[model samples]
Target: MNLADIPLRPGGAELLPVRGVRARQAFDNRDWVAVEIPVALEFNGIAHAVMLATPTDLADFALGFALSEGILLARGELYGIEEEYGPEGITLKLEVASAAFARLKERRRSMAGRTGCGLCGTESLAHVSRALPALPPGPSLSKSAVARGMRELASLQVLQKVTGAVHAAAWCTAEGEALLVREDVGRHNALDKLVGALAKSTLAASTGFIAVTSRASFEMVQKTVAAGVPLLAAVSASTSMATAVAQETGLTLAGFVRGDDLVIYTHPGRLNGQPATA
Candidate 1:
């Protein structure tokens, strides 16, 4: 796939007037802020969840959410999607296959997800983790490659550069070259966007690692493993629960990616220090 053809930027930011103080000096100026609106998802006329997200790339968000959340086993289950814009928010109307809709009905749950909130309305501990295919051993990559991808992700985050409120998810190659990057106000939303984008792209997701700007969370690791990515690099620390998930799934998880240094939590073989996983 031609990388240039993929839509990278989530529309621009909004300039809002704000009063702020810097160095004990009060000043009034317009600041660029990320757009956050209620994005509702409806499958076969049934309401599923409502998420606060930036409005751009709703299509990717719709497809990505369904696959990552285990709503649809494959993209074919989603026949079509329509967007209905109301004064309150945007609703994504997804026309799914009967099998997919039936499955959704059986395991239905409602979630009014907040910004950066995952599993907000999970009813039970069992539903928190979904069964997915085990990931294969990933490429043997150097720590420098992971850092390179994370560093490149900084410049590629067009939305975050303007609005300090957003996070980014980037797909990087084995050599640590970032190819696809998606941004959102919520970290999970950004990863979902990237997962959706990867599903639609021709690139082989298994051959690369996913890098995120936010601290690693359980949902973040779950989504990355669900997408078949071998490694996950976070700009900050990893939680104990997230580390456990990575260990259980054989996913190489790395956190606190500052320059050349990163602490690998599990499946360290994906890095150059050890042999690659089989």
Candidate 2:
């Protein structure tokens, strides 16, 4: 369906005025663009990191960032979250347990004005690979389940279909039903949002796998491991670092997942059954 027919939901896409030319015809058009803005995450009133992301789901984004970055070990460590919006952007004021805050100060990792995903503003290479947690003995997804999950994930991207400029991360059951989905301009941001959502929900996320509409990066693998999910299936190829980390962490990583056609980068055993065309 066209944008004209789509009813804008909460935190929906923005329409920008622009000129269009097609088939030697020039006309005025309003293009749909995903919202991208600078979001600052502050803990205990101390400035932490600034990232460009969609303004929606700031709460989930903040909590997810804290968990994935290993800043706060448990959600209970986060006491409260408040939002302050201004002309500059949104600032997330997070009140955390004193212990967690102290640890954060010790690390002194500041990512102000960071845009895309990566270990930006990290103080040292040693901080590149944080200690990963032991994953649960998760349910294995069959080849068919992975294919079905991708199909469900692709169809559930309401925001992407409207703006066509965002990545989505989906949490799917072993049977391939997409139970949860989150979208953002940045792929890692999407995954982080999904992680946070899972934490907030009552769902037993360990029974499912993660499917992303972007390539598998090392940080992505790390986040998946931290989320305690067993597998990460991406739409594109996996990076060397991502593959290595997955192999080391016992996380199943799959890339180039288009229907039944896919490449299992590491721990192929996680794909429970034989493959076939979807």
Candidate 3:
């Protein structure tokens, strides 16, 4: 299926343009609409969780979800992912070997149907702020690279361009060259897709900086660290908790990365030049 053909805002009302005075003109009025879809993710024979996603990158979504949730150690452990489409919705059947299943059982202790929510089964503030392993130190990215990466990220977001309703995450090297890009309605999902693509390409994520078109949330920092990427650049602001996580994980977090200016939240040493005193 054409990526462009997929609805930008899934489950939203059809966009019918009003005819204008110009004979060949075509445009639709901007409107905000909620997107909801049934995405049932089944593990082995047990139904794990059903979510509502924009349904563009279900494979990436499945793989990323498995990795982020600690359901699988690596991509190799996942045998296969099959999407079963029916009248009800899309059911993602993820097949894994017994070893991975065993590991998942140990990692995830709860089974109370906290299905659709991204941060599922977390009962307390402590769980909400789980620890992430420290990121290995990587090469510092140039100022120009950071700026170019953010601009390239915007161009790669086809869904967001059409609907203005999605976020994008991209990776680039220290020399202003973008490598991979992923888009999703949720910022975390976009990062996950980028990570999954990075894994698939067998690229050394350590050599590049991860750029996101969303606010730097704690999970965003956590996911970047989990991918072993040391640098994260976001187009929007970062929460205080997110900065703390970045600092703890030894990841360089840059926020408000628009055209020319950016705010370095932590690890300013990753910038090409010397740290700027604010």
Candidate 4:
């Protein structure tokens, strides 16, 4: 799809004209800015949560949210999705299986108004951290592949290139080819869109890892682990909590992926080759 041809409102970003002052000089310019809005998600006619996100690729956002949030067990459980626009915000009404709907209600009864933080609505410490199965063994990626993937990630961020305020998440093969990429104002939202896009496709995720143009936070590691992606590469640093989670879940986490150098926080064996230097 040609993103340039798409309208801004539905495309999740907007370009606004503004006045700029630089070095005591004033001029007029137009800036591409990311659009953040309230998105209400409803499952089986019951309101679930409201998130602040970019309003594009909402279908993918809906499905990815459901899966990463553990509301639905499988993609098959999400029967339908209906979008409604109003003066307030956009609402995504999703039709899910009865079993899943029941689980959602039970889960919601314990907490309300979950934010996009990915852990905001948890009622207890146990709920804050979800138990994930050990990641299945996957093909090792070479340092060259990781370097290539980092280089490719910059060009793939079409939205970020325009807005200069968005994050991107991409799925790349072991050979460093980026197959799909999603962008959003929120890092978690970008990852969710990528996961949803991957889930809707017939691709085998086990053959690849994920790359993000943002710092590796705990929620980032959580979502990657939940999606069963073994390795995650970030353009910046990883938080201490994020590294701990990555270690416990057996997810290979790498940060500071600039040019040919990257720091592997866990599972260094998955990255094959001598570490590149500055």
Name the best candidate (by lDDT): 1
| Total clashing pairs in model 3 | 0
1-278 in candidate 4: lDDT tens per residue?
24333343687667777898999999899887777777889898988787778888999999998888788878999999999977667889999999999878766633333224566666667666667777766567787787788788888888888888888899998899998899888888899899999999887887788999889999899889888888899999999999998888778899999998999998787785322111
Query: Scored by CA lDDT, what does every candidate get?
Result: 0.86, 0.84, 0.74, 0.82
Judged by whole-model lDDT over C-alpha atoms, candidate 2 comes out at 0.84
- Residue-by-residue lDDT tens digits, candidate 2, 225-245: 998888899999999999988
Global CA lDDT computed for model 3: 0.74
- After aligning candidate 2 to the native by TM-score, how far in Å is the CA of 245 from where it should be? 0.9
Q: Ten consecutive residues with minimal summed lDDT in candidate 2?
A: 1-10
For model 2 the local lDDT of residue 261 reads 96
lDDT of 1: 0.86
In order, how many clashes per candidate?
Answer: 0, 0, 0, 0
The 10 consecutive residues of candidate 4 with the worst lDDT sum are 109-118
How well is each residue in 8-114 modelled by candidate 1, as lDDT tens digits?
Answer: 34464776689989999999999887888788999999999999888778888899999898887877888999998776777899999998888887777878899
Displacement of the residue 86 alpha carbon in candidate 4, Å: 1.1
Off by over 4 Å in 1: 1-12, 23-25, 273-278
Identify the runs in model 3 with alpha carbons over 4 angstroms from their true place: 1-36, 109-121, 124-126, 273-278
Worst 10 residues of 1 by lDDT: 1-10
Of the candidates numbered 1 and 4, which has the greater TM-score value?
A: 1
